[model samples]
Target chain A: MDAAAETTPLLSVRDLRVSFALDEGLVRAVDGTSFDVMPGQVLGVVGESGCGKSVTMRAILQLVERPGRITSGEIRFRRDGEIVDLARLPPRGPVMRDIRGGEIALIPQEPMAAFSPVHTVGEQIIEAILLHGHRWGEKKLSRKDARDITVGLFRDVGISMPSQRVDAYSWQLSGGLRQRAMIAMALSCKPRLLIADEPTTAIDVTTQAQVLALLRDLQAKYNTAIIFITHDLGVIAQMASYVVVMYLGRVMEQGPVDEIFHTPKHPYTQALLRSIPSMTGTTRVALPVISGALPHPFNRPAGCPFHPRCPDVMERCSKAVPSLRPVTPTQLASCFLHHDQAEPS
Target chain B: MSDTAASPLLEVRGLQKFFPITKGFFQRVVGHVRAVDGVDFTVNEGETLGLVGESGCGKTTASRCILRAVDPTGGSINYRTRDGRTVDLATLSPAELRPLRAEIQMIFQDPFGSLNPRMTLLDNVGEPLLVNGMSNRNERTARVAELLRVVGLRPEFMHRFPHAFSGGQRQRIGIARALATNPRLVVADEPVSALDVSVQAQVLNLLLELQSRLKLTFLFVAHDLSVVRHISDRIAVMYVGQLVELAPTDAIFNRPLHPYTAALMRAVPPADPRVRITDGILGGEVPSPAAPPSGCYFHPRCRFAEERCRVEAPALREVTSGRFSRCHFAGELSL
Candidate 1:
């Protein structure tokens, strides 16, 4: 609970480690991940499948399932000039419930399954609003007024014909409409923070673009800190102000969006950036890929997690884990090449 | 630049593939799924034709019909098989299509799912050879090794299982497997979509390099326009169960005729910060193929939809030289 750090970052995570205890042993899904999201700023967490980007966000929500727990770390949420330690809060207590869907709303990857199939989209949105609408008593407005407000929220999220579509079932709606409905539900709570996890992966390219643009516009209008997780760098380029590159349960690098995309310090981040198909007129000759497969959680590497696939691997890289350290004024990387290696110059 | 000046290597004329939607417990024929109502396109020799659309747009079904992997309800699929023999793929039986399978190989979307986990990389690549009654294990090993080398993988890795390789490498293995039979035409369904973005390029470059070296024709189907743009010589945009636009790579990218095509192009997020596309976004999802709206399937969500679009189904007609669009007012649309 650092007050001085609260001046800039709305949410600051430090040395966050999330592990799952299975029959095999402890599997570190998120190992010592740390980053900050300033208010009204969009931070893109980019990584491929099972890279722990989602795990890190789940850790913040304290929604990690059984056997998985935050071993050690600090997740501080700055509100009203006071830093609240999220990690210390009980998972299902009264204080936690107030913040879970109220202060921080989540737009999950798949919109179809995220909402209850039985409940109408409006009902779900109303439930979220009811939970967070503290100032309004149980009967702040009549049922009809609440319905009207829900429709308005839906319209704000760009869902067409909100009046009639409000009564429609989730299955009756198209993928795009369902996604917009999910956004409407998330925004209805008036959360200060929004966690969007691969919100566009399932939809078509055109719909994906619309949803991304909508998220950016909504983020600005709400002045909320957004934690955008996605596998697409093109999307991150369009939306993110800051970027955090994760690989095999660790933060490979973190920096400003431009710096991360143009001049990534970490080899993995650079490889990822180069991999994206560019519309920037830069002819993509074959992109460089990490040499080996990602190390699974069960077969965790002894030292640096990405050492097996690192192009600049050394004898020491396999023997010591590199801590997330500052590579530049605004850039941070966890690689032996950047840590204490011989200067190239 | 006349339409009839040159013939396409593989021409699909009014291709239709409909799955019977049985209702009764006795499996009564109640209705047809209309999976591929009527799709028409051509794949010129040695040219990569990119087939792009959202999921369930009949892209996969159309591919299956081309490869004779599935039966088509109607239409003539004129294609040139190996040994420079031209034949209609749709009418051929499995026994007669055996030789054609060697000529028109398919690389499936999921490398992990497509490959047999229990089998070695060498076996997976060499399966076609073995299946074709190549009893010599040593010959299969040599051929598989050469393919591995061609795909930029070391021969030693052939002994390893697919589970050991990265997604990109696994896709290379899939590509090598498809090429093992020396197929002239390869139908690659979302080949790079399964791999990591960085890995996708490696696989794409490998496919491109292989295409040129072997003088192979490709029918690359994918949902990602960016990947399709990089590799395809020509691109076809599909909506619902029909082709909305067909044009050359640059034509499709720069001057799309169909509204759907234009919207899809605009949807491609510009990699650079300077250029911003004016077309806002496609408003809604593609309508269901089972009950596609009358006339043009895209008319429901199309911004330029008009009275003609609601009543008369637009046929694929030449909008410009070497470009085709299916819209009531194809040229009139501002798109």
Candidate 2:
């Protein structure tokens, strides 16, 4: 923890904005989102579907597809005491490519689609190793060396019998094993930062526990910074040290995990927390849901995006947008309820 | 909620569903995938029984068998009809079961796929009425409008197609369709799983309200334990097509009798960050249903398995007044 306080942040995103150019108009998928990922700590980006949690992560890696573009923001990444603006790098250039897979690797949501069916899992993992392994103070690694490294990574992710299982294709493996293989591929380069985008959502609950434990262990061992993106608040609570709450492509709240769970300031964050069914015998009653559906992106409401459903909407809530301001020393909220002179009732 | 006070609304005994695995040019019967093997449970009048398990655990198969959507390989599904007649759904012929179809209906998981894209909300909700000999268009339209109002949708929106509505609204339409025939039993297979978190609560509350208002009995099958706990009176835990534990919702979460149930309870990530899971993390993947382990099916992954558990299967036995378990050391273990 002291190392995190002393050193510069591993990755810093500032006021990031990403928009999609549809025929109708521009849809701001990610708007003015900012957060920091420190060394060896997990930052959870949480929101419902269409809330731009995934888009924010994609913007960091410069992987937003065609028709979607990162219009502005600075994604400054600190590597070897040098800062690089990732948002300025060309999307498919050599420097961006090396930074993407070599310095910051990703474990995508669907392992089935991410992996190739024709090649063996081991062969694909070895290719990743060879592609990025040259940066590890060595000119190059032999095929056997890459294979051994891949096997070691497989074993690290808790895949049993890596030597034999590595030869199996992606479809031949179960959902849990395929996800583990994907994690191994992400960790093959020993990257400084890992972006895990819903990596456990596809697997079963029991396998989810194992994979989460494996990630915590690996993060502790390597001191790798992680940006864990998920819609499940339970998952965010379990895995993340700091949390970012998003809604309608904007940051609603940002704080330490404990504060976010115990003392969420924004009405959107509070309503989202209350909406989840608790497991500890406290959720048999009806959950307090945020009423009304998320407004369509094209017809986004003026002023506060969440005022339509917010329980504590004031007169000022629907007139102008609220910028994120500090509600506490370590917590920020973008709601007028926190900034008003009167106490929130 | 007493099991013996009155006859159960639905009693399923020794239900089994097996799909044949074939290979080669002749497509010979090479093996069998025992999707649901000898599962038994009962749903009382106006009560919700949650059948929960991971993917491919046969909860869906059991529900489908109860509705007779898919013919069961064996066992009896004794359902007491609305007119107070007991009929074995598994043994009934297709011709004989046509009239009984109106008494049992299913609510699917995906609202988008289950609804017809071309049909308006009224047509989708009133199709069951039309098929069941309701020829009067005014009567069906009025009933559809009332049903739409009951589900919190505007009656005027009945003319719109499914694509015009949001996911939550479409789910409401599906519920309206399920209730069109006034079913005695509603088998909702992961009804709210496809909706978002905020919308999930809305649909769940609506289901609970309708269950009470209409006096409907439900067999809710879902993988999420928390959602099941919120809506179900009792829960039956399944593993590899077998009922590992059956108890009230509180007992299932508070004092799980079966090891699998206990492990599953621990596996659910708590919404509180302070509550970290430090012990009893389950290991290994769920064994394939095509070739399950011998003796006790969960023996390979059971941490408390003994030599006897490796060689002998444990029958489902009552551990308490209402709780049941399928463990060799059911009452002995503190789990």
Candidate 3:
């Protein structure tokens, strides 16, 4: 868990606590979540909606909205062998502005909302590139030069007829093309870490596969660490090297993708796997739903949040929250079963 | 497969829908966008036929045409109702179609947006019944409660408005509304695509359960292959307003003949992490529906496109007993 190993993590987030000041009380959106992403690693974050996966990823870039603040944790970002504490940086300061897109870039879920309706996609991309390029005292290029690079970036992201597409606004482009434009904009600055939050949710299956493959190839070529957030385990299988299972703002389990998919230890993870419609399995009588919806942010359980829905919940699960214990090599899970066997105090 | 004799509940042939593109203040018709062009398919009684494609590929338009929500410029929609009466739905006048509305219903994609926010859940579900002149409010409320239970929502939720519930709950309300009149055929347009993954399974399961219990025929439109495969007994693949492939679910998944279908299958990620994915095959975006490719619409991205494919529009022809494909080289491709 050392942050300074040979494979130094580009982004190391530990004990991240993000909460919202609601009318009733303080609601924990991301409670003590922790994970890491190394160079060229695609860390898949999977969860049901409202499980705080997006909130945890947003916390890294300090993008959490007002009234919902990061209460504790260190988002230690490594840039050019220099480590900077992201959580400690003052909001809107030069240090924060420099690292926002220069070192850490974000590809949001909904491209329709991400890009302005009036602005052409090329202008949006140029703005992102300028943010990073200007950090090194780079002069603003001519309009033609900016347009050329925008076209090039579009082509790099696999948009056919990039020149024609540069003139179109976000509304004119299809869902898949809009997402590709978002990816192009995110990667235009060439950040070390790319956080793609459900990039393919709106697009079709074919477009999703193409975009994912493009992201993988680009990750390899650029050696950019990625924190990919999605609900589809299928997409995770295709993109992630490591997998993180989240529930009710906590890390339910974390391990390598293969291990997590094949030999999932947590009941929640197993239920998730079983819920997926499989090509190999028998015709399902009924989809095995996870029994209940995710807990409301304000009414999160006192103990294990997943205990109510878990089929194999024990008596002790409802009393105390389980800390993430080491289950296997590079695998950790927060469950009462693990706590029972690994009790030391 | 079950050998039971089942009649076609709905038959659509050579269906075409074109929207005019007008420009400037003069409002001159610039060109026609053939949103749905020359599509044919049949849904058997008590079976789910999934229509799947990328957005703007005309699946939604085809469904809308079948329901006459958007009138088709050409072709036939023959519906055999529950009373053993066959009717050419397209030729019917507005007054004539009113009686048949109870036999066919549609569930829209955005459940929240589709339902009336001003109405209570009970009122939304009861609208269809009320429109059909079911005058008893008590009876309507009873039926709504029954539907709520059928869709796995609590009967008490009927009093609440759509904004009060979560996305999954709103979808269930939408389903209950669709089933209020006990329609023989329901067109569910991307029913669960709007919900979360976990909630999607729940809603899908609920739909499947309702279908079996009510013995309803379904036209399920979705873009997700895995979801379509799970619920659909038969599947249709569409591209640029054309039906490229149609077959049984397993047949389409295991032995898709059309190159476009094969490429689409290859594009979907496997559930198992251990499985190796074919590098994304078809490249480039779908051509404009307004002016599709002259020959085969797919030839632009098709890896196996030939000289003939680029010039000749392939027709949808039966390649096997129950499978249809539109590719000239479909015989050579393994699904």
Candidate 4:
């Protein structure tokens, strides 16, 4: 690693690829996707369903399941003055397990399914704390100490009556409270990086706003980096500093949040932004939508996956795949529109 | 859009639907959960009325009560039929209501669960027609093919089942089924909420086009403010089993009357990143319907709530020309 790379980013992924082995053929879930998450910054990954955003995050902590393998990539994570490649780590091994929850934690989409029904929410959080507390210098926390810590965590996430709520079962709590408990558990280890996969998608709008504010407050207090993954561009604009737009297993564009929203380079990104309904004006008009749907995974398109739906598609776009090249000083887009204007290496 | 000369297509007054909360093995009724309490609104001809609220706010209950899916406890649902006949749907008998069912149809939220797995798309969409005296199989097939074409789907693909289609396509199939009877008023409950953003736009556009072509009036129920604002001519904001505000879409977005409505408008995340939400963030959750707070249901969460709002419940009254609000200081407070 270079000196600048060593001191700058907390995690850097280069040319990452992940594929699922189906009965018919190989489904490239994530193909040649790369982005970096700096310390104390939230990186948002926005995409539609089946766009491989979730698969790429799953590949980061070595959590890819059976039939899905990280084919070739370099996920270099900086830890204690050492650079470790997470792509080659065995999923269930002891070292990877320690790094999975201790250094990198995940907050899943559905909180009801993530927590156990039989156990009280407090017990589950305590179990997580005990399992990973050693990394944070809490070697021997008794049951009482762990319970106290869990209560504190619940309070931190803006839950009312933390002591009473900690003992409540997952099914007893509402959707908003269940999500808050999930956030508390994810923060139990104080992981340097948190991967929140659509954490507020299932909740109400008011509750979503509250959760987003809470996340911003917690990130400022703990100084932890975040990888927020969602399909909502509105939430992305509110939460992330840097943004990455992904299509069918590929990075369509990546840049700062302001640039991606204000001056999008990729046709897919621009179209996606135009499709969202605006709240400022009360104009009863039809939204501008993309022409076609995402192609089937098994019957993937030849070159660019979005060429069929792209409004500014060229003849060459259907025949050749364009690599991610610089569109602006801070933005990069993988489109043939910028192929000729790109600066020479 | 507010045409005073033309009568309302459907008018609901003092609608109430309460489920008894029983206790112990004997199942004795102790109290009632007022799911739809005194909701009043009107859907004019060829206009969309958006009903919006958070979860557990009784929007679904009100829609279901209007359709008589669940028998309401008390209310008058006056629906004008195609032949210019007014009928009280809430008081109608089962046999008497069977014919009117074809005039008011419902489109459910989940396309996956709403469509039967074993049935083909043709049977699913054509079943309503078959039940309503269209017994000939060939005629039913022809009509089903035409309806599918209207929804932008291939007629040949009607032979395939719901499992062979995507979420958006299945939603289109649901729309086709809802439109099979040419209903005057269609009640759609979060129709496009389950689809992706790109597909949501497609479905919204389709709904807009169908409304114009078929001259259909809609009661579009959804939680998203932007989507509701885009399709609705007039919007009704609901809170704990009550209508807090009812006004034109532009009035509700620009000059809200109720505090709850103002907070709801502010809560929606703007599409532009530079627009920051400075104030009016709602706090706490909706109170339980069984034991809702006395006086105003939203006093606990409302920022401008005063002492009068805590002691006495406010009745929904007309505040301006075409706007109504349930707040005590509706016209006084510039929300």
Best by TM-score: 2
Error of 4 at A140 (Å): 3.5
Off by over 4 Å in 4: A1-7, A340-345, B1-5
DockQ of each: 0.48, 0.75, 0.61, 0.72
Query: How does model 1 score by TM-score?
Result: 0.90
**Which lDDT tens digits does candidate 2 get at residues B1-335?**
34532558899999999999999999999999999999999888888999999999999999999878789999999988877889999999989898999989999999889999999998999999999999899999999999899999999998999998888889999999999988878999999998989899899989988987898889999999889999998999999999999998887788898899999989989999999988899998899999999889999999999999999999999989889999999988887
lDDT over C-alpha atoms for residue B1 of model 2: 39
Give fnat for candidates 1, 2 and onward, in order.
0.48, 0.70, 0.61, 0.65
Alpha-carbon deviation at A95 in model 3, angstroms:
0.5
Candidate 4's DockQ: 0.72
Candidate 2: which docking quality band?
Answer: medium
Candidate 1 lDDT over B1-335, as tens digits, reads: 12422656799988999988888789998777788878899888788899999888899999988987788999999987656677888898888888777887999889879999999988899999998878799999999999999989999998899988777778888889999988888999999888876577778778877887898888999998888887877899888889989998877777778988888878877654335544557776777677789988888888888898899999999988888999878778677
TM-score of chain A of each: 0.92, 0.95, 0.93, 0.95
Residue B142, model 1, lDDT: 98
Give the poorly placed runs of model 3, Cα more than 4 Å off.
A1-5, A80-82, A117-119, A134-155, A159-175, A341-345, B1-5
Candidate 4 B-chain TM-score? 0.98
lDDT by residue (A1-345, candidate 3, tens digit) is 344553777788888889999788998998888888887788999998889999887788888898999999889988766899888888688888878888788999999999999989988887776656754346776667667888988998889899999889999998888998999988877787899998988787777888888898888888888999999888899899999999988899999999999989999999989887776554526888888776667778877889988988998788778888888877899997765642222
Between 1 and 4, whose DockQ is larger? 4
Better of 1 and 4 by lDDT: 4
Global CA lDDT computed for model 3:
0.86
Which model, 1 or 3, shows the larger DockQ?
A: 3
| Candidate 3 interface RMSD value | 1.5
